[model samples]
Target: MKNLVILGAGTAGTMMANHLVSKLPKKDWKIHIVDQFKTHYYQPGFLFLPFDIYTEEQVKKVGKKFIPKGVNYIQQRIEKIDAENNLVDLENGTLSYDILIIATGSKIAPDEVEGMMSEEWKKSIFDFYTYEGALALRNKLRDWQGGKLVVHITEMPIKCPVAPLEFAFLADSYFKKKKIRDKVEITYVTPLSGAFTKEFCSKSLGYLLEEKNIKLVTDFAIERVDFENNKIIDYIDKEVGYDLLVTVPTNMGDEVIERSCLGDDLNFVPTHPNTLQSLENENIFVIGDATNVPASKAGSVAHFQAETLTDNILLYIDNKPLKEEFDGHANCFIETGNNKALLIDFNYKQEPVTGTFPFSGIGPLKLLKESIFNHWGKLAFRWIYWNMLLKGISIPFVSRNMSLKGKNINN
Candidate 1:
């Protein structure tokens, strides 16, 4: 039987396995998925963890529960990939494959920033990217009486760019609910020149930051965390002191990519923008946060890519031309707290614009504007993610390719 090996059973790899296994003839192909961890985290849930919106039970599940019966699930740590030999080296043994998919996701390296790993890490400074970190931050925020709370992003191209901003907004709400809004001060620091990377969305979200009284310090490149002084020092020596620091540290692809010698300087797999196939190796493919695709490393991107990628994988097996079409489509809801949120939709060529989503004139969801419906959409997504997304079932009103039908192009 022809073997197809998939690495990392995160959102991308999990969905890919489900898509391909259902379509490929079971008599001819054998699918094997490998990952070190057994628990599957609804990673997006991590964003809400710090705010007490989701508990540990809501987000954690067994990876084996999601894998279809026809697929082989191997729990092993990947040591490296011998891409040249079409083999994956595990801690225990090496597995060979005819075709390989790299869906190994990205990770945050707090140590990449000096002083970030110091004693004050989970106490005065914290990260919400991981479950443990998020839970720690939640506890830290609970007893935080009052002080300058800085929400900083050390670098860009990080997973879920909007998450830091959401944290800032949520922190504001959390403080107000605790009767400490007047006692605490909130500031958002980023390397980017605006609240968001996209121009139109930046304008909208920047206004939100201003409206919420969250001070914005743009274009500040963080150099180190001065835990002794409770300050974050930037490259230009600009300093922001804080009693509590919530940071989005430098994010990079998995270490196995570096060991495998298949990734770029940032350890991200080089991928063609339209095709979703690994540029370095023809027999290999990459999806999700693992690929440098210039798309948001969000679940929505993976959901869209899985559809197109599944078709291309089939084409490759049949000696047919790959359907070179992934438009970098991504949609995400920005939680602004107070039972309100904003939705944005865009592709590689277009920035987010103001309008309705899915349907131009008749959308239950509006883009680039904060509304209660959008908040419900954000909350309802958790259900969809667990039931439909991970199950490889496609949702209506969304497509594999980005659609400009409902978006206002003029901005």
Candidate 2:
């Protein structure tokens, strides 16, 4: 039987396994999935963990539970990816594949920046990108008296690019609810010139920063963290002081990509934007955060790409031309604090526009506007992710590609 191997049992890899198990002929092929960790984290919940919005049990599950019954699940660390010979080296053994899927995702690299991971890490400074980081920050926020709370982003191309902004918004609500709003000062520092990389999105969401009374320090590229004095120094010697620093450090792909020599400077694999295939190898496919695609490295983008990639994988077995179908479609919900959120739907070409989703004029969920309904929708997504999304059950009415039928482009 032909062997099909998948790397990482995270969001992207899990979804691809579910998508292909039923599509690929069982008589001719066998599937194997590898991952080092046993837990499957609901990554979106990491944002809410620091604020006590989601309990510990709500964000994680046993990784083995998500793998389909027919697939082989291996829980082991990957030593390297020998892409040259189409082999994957695991800690225990080697895997040869007729087809390989790389869904190994990106991670926060605190070491990339000087002093970011020094003596102050998880003490006065923390990150919510990892479970340990989120839980530690939660404990820190539990009984600590309020002071300057600096939410900073070291660089761009981080996972869930809107996450740092959401944390700032939620911190506003959290402090207010705790009756410590007057005691806390919230500052959002970013390397980018505005709230977001996209021009339209930056303009649309810019007012919220001022509305929340959070200080916005733009275009400040950090050079190092002064853990001794509790201040971050920028390249030009500009300084931002903070009592409690919650920073998103530079994000890079899995180190295996670096050892494989298949990735760019940031350790992201060079991938075709639309096809989701590796630029160097025709038999290998890449999806989600691992690829150097210019799309937002969010879970919804992976779900959309999984559909297109499954088809391409089947075509490759039959010696057919792969479809250039993925369009960088991404749908994200931005929490704006106060039990409200804003949703944005866009592709590589389409900018986020104000409209109703899944319907032209009758959407029950509004886009680009803060509402309690959107907040509920955002919270309800956690359920959808566990039950429907990972199981390969398609979301009702939401197409894989972006549709401009209902979106008001003129706005």
Candidate 3:
């Protein structure tokens, strides 16, 4: 039997497994997925955890529940990949594969930032990227009582780039509802030149940040955390004092990539921008946060890639030309709180513009504009994620490629 080995059974791998299992013949193809963890996390939900929007129970589920039964699920830590020999070494044994898929998702390592892992990590400084960090921050927030709360991003290319902004907005609302808005002072620290990476999106979001009275420290490169003095010092010697620090630390791809010597400086696999194939090996495919593509590391990007990869993998098996159709399509809902949110859809060639989404001239969702209906759609996504998205079912009026139907190209 031919081997099809998949690394990391997270969002991208799980979705690919579900999408490919029915397509590939079980008798001929022995599908094997490897990951150390048994529990899968709804990573997007991590954004809401600090604000008490999602509980611990809601964010986690057994990996086996999402993984298809026919596929062999190997719970093992990968040592490295010998791509030249087409073999992967794990803690237990070596697994050989005819085709390999790298879906090992990214992680936030606070240790990457100087002084972040020392002294006051979970006490004064906390991160919501992990379950433990989220719970810790939740407890801290519960008794905060009001002070200088700084929500900071250590670096860029973090999963869900919009999450930090969402957190800032939500915190503003949360404090207001708790009648402590005046008592609390919130500041947003980012490495980016604006609130968001994209210029247009940044323009809109930056204005919102100002309106909410959440201060923005842009273009500030973090040098270290001065936990001893209760401040964060930037490379330029500027410091921001804080009573509570909520941070999104440096995010990198799984350690397996680092061990395998198949990744870039940050352990992200070097992938063909348009093809979704690994630059080091054609037989290996990478998706989601694992790839060093200049695209948003969001679930929507992974879903779009899975469909194109499905076709490309089949083509590889049939000795046909690979279809290079993935256009960096990414869509995300930015929660602005108070029963309002904004949606943005764009690809490599296009930036987010004020328009409707999924349809031209008529949409149930508007892009880059706040509306209660958009908020409902954002909440409804959790259900859609589990049912339609994870199951490889298509979303209505949505396609993998960015459509120009409702987009204001002239603007």
> How much lDDT does each candidate structure score?
0.91, 0.94, 0.90
Q: Residue 281 CA error for candidate 3 (Å)?
A: 0.7
Reference-based TM-score of each model? 0.99, 0.99, 0.98
Cα lDDT tens digits for candidate 2, 168-216 = 9999999999999889999999999988767888888889988989999
Q: What's the lDDT of the predicted structure labeled candidate 1?
A: 0.91
Per-residue alpha-carbon lDDT of model 3 for 48-70, expressed as tens digits?
Answer: 78788888888788888888879
lDDT score of residue 111 within candidate 1: 93
C-alpha RMSD of candidate 2? 0.8
RMSD of each: 0.8, 0.8, 1.1
User: Which one wins by lDDT: 1 or 3?
Assistant: 1
**lDDT (Cα, tens digit) per residue for candidate 1, span 271-351:** 987888899889999999999999999999999999999999999999999998999999999999998999999889989
Inter-residue clash pairs, candidate 1:
none
